[model samples]
Structures are given as structure tokens and as C-alpha cells.
Target: MRFPGFTGEWKETTAAETCSEFKSGKGLKAENILSEGLYPVYGGNGLRGYTSTFNHDGFFVLIGRQGALCGNINIAEGKSYITEHAIAVQANTENVTGFFQYLLLNMNLGQYSDQSAQPGLAVNKLLKLRINLPSKEEQQKIATMLSLLDARIATQNNIITTVC
Candidate 1:
């Protein structure tokens, strides 16, 4: 399946090629997570809480790197702290981060997690995984479309919450 007016085959590439960085975040103890603060804290499963400090600024794609939720993905932007349980990904300038987020969501990376006392995803493993890539222009279009749909969904949820 593909969008209209966009034609051409997507190139096959490795995750490593599409991304410039796949490093784990610094460890922030559970007690450090505050109810509310200046920066949002991101962990394996997503936003854990907030804290006074931030380790990363700007946009990033975070992958849950450990525990039952290994391989789960989340998007973070602005001032945010990514904990040790999440690997912060920086997509290459040639690719759109939003498009990679949706692509990873569809990939179901959980299946790649290693079975252990606590399942985990290794950065090296993710780097070796195969992926398909389209032109930068096409990627932007796809990301824009998905982002709009997501906004609509969020709005609908708010409406439902208000009514019910």
C-alpha cells in the first residue's frame, strides 16, 4: 500500500543506515521521577514522570530497551530526559523522524526482544534490522498525514471524555 501521487520503489536499508545514533539514555533512579517538574522523563514504557533536569533536547524516537515492554516505542520532543531503559534514536537527516515513528509502530519490535528473566532489546540488534525507506519528500507526506490523523483521534478522545 502507498499514498497517491507518490510513485517509486522504497529502498531496502538497515536500521543502522537510517539512523545516526542508537544509544541508551542515562540512568535516573525511580525516586528521581517527580509528579511534575520542568522536564518530562521518558523510560522503557514511555513517559515515567517529570524531573528538574533534561538529558536531551529537540526531537527523538525512543525505544524501550528492557523489561516486559522492551521494543515498545515512543516519540519525545523539546526538553526531555530519557532514562536508561530507553534507547534514544536519532534518525539520519535524510529521513523523517515522524515517519520512522509510524514505521516502527507498525514493525512490532517486541518480537525481536530476547527472552530472559527480563526481556530486553539490544541497540546492536536494532541496528542490524532491515527496513525499507522512501524518498525524503514522500516520507514527509506520510508523516504529515499520520500526524493529522493522530490529532483527530486525540480530539475525539477528549470529546468522549467530556461527554461520558
Candidate 2:
């Protein structure tokens, strides 16, 4: 991000400045998934596969690393796996909010995008990304505000569909 109105410039930061670690998910074969269960399986993109086993149980951002849906970030539920080629960033409570970190990632991803015709995200490049952040309180408020907007949009869409 660049400074607006002033000649001063925004700073560049390493990914470590904002979090504790960037960890990848577990490897599970698809045949293991029970027909219906309580675990989430994430692959190069969103929930590409399924499983009955879980690796982590908490709020975290799953950053897709190398595939068709690479740059996209998905929020995981109580229990899940990251899979190969995807890195999960578990927020470091003191510096970043879990939802807010996901928002920031969703907001600004172009810089790390390979910009290929296929447009795949780079793990090495993503892990080094430094984001300009707002204060924790501000981040919380933004998350709340956006969440409201999302809820309202969902309601509105439901109303429209009902009418249709």
C-alpha cells in the first residue's frame, strides 16, 4: 500500500512480522472419507476432497498454493486439513485477528499472484508477503462490519429468490 496525500511511502514487511508460522496440511487419501462426517478436507483450492480425520481444530486461513484456485483463501471450521501445496496461517492472537487476517489476504493478493494466464498462487512468494495492517480493534470492527454486510446480502438475496 502506498501513502495517500503525502510523499511518505508505506513499508514492506515480511510475513513473519504478522504471524507465528506458515504450516501445511496433512496428507490423506480420498478413499478414507466416510460418507458423512464432521471433518473438513481442503486441497489446492477450497474443499476439493473430504475426510473423517482432522488435523487442527480452530479458526485458521487456508491459503491455496499451487493449482487452478491457488490464490484464493478459505476459512476453516473447527476441524480440518490443509493438504499439499496449500499453507495455513493460524493467526498469532497478539498481532492479528484470525478473521481479519483472512480478510487482509482476500483483500490484497494480486502482489503475490503469479499473474499467469492460469493465475496460480506461489507458496514461497506468499509466505514472504508483508501486509499493511490496521490496529487490532480496527480489524475487529472491520470484520464485524463486513460480516453484517455479508448477512444482509444473504438476506436480501433470499428475499429476492423468494419473490422470484
Leading candidate by lDDT? 1
lDDT of all predictions, in order shown? 0.90, 0.66
What is candidate 2's CA lDDT for residue 162?
Answer: 100
In every candidate, how many clashes are there?
0, 0
Q: Write the per-residue lDDT of candidate 2 for residues 60-107, one digit (tens) a residue.
A: 777777655566677777887667656777667755555445555576
Error of 1 at 37 (Å): 1.7
Clashes of 2: 0
Model 2 alpha-carbon drift over 4 Å, by segment: 1-12, 99-102, 105-120
lDDT of 2: 0.66
Flag regions of model 1 displaced more than 4 Å.
none
Residue 37 of model 2: what lDDT? 65
- Model 2 lDDT-worst window of ten: 1-10
Tens digit of lDDT per residue, candidate 1, span 1-164? 78888899999998788887678999998888999999999998999999999999978989999998788889899999999899998788998888888888889989999988999988898889899989999999999999999999999999999999
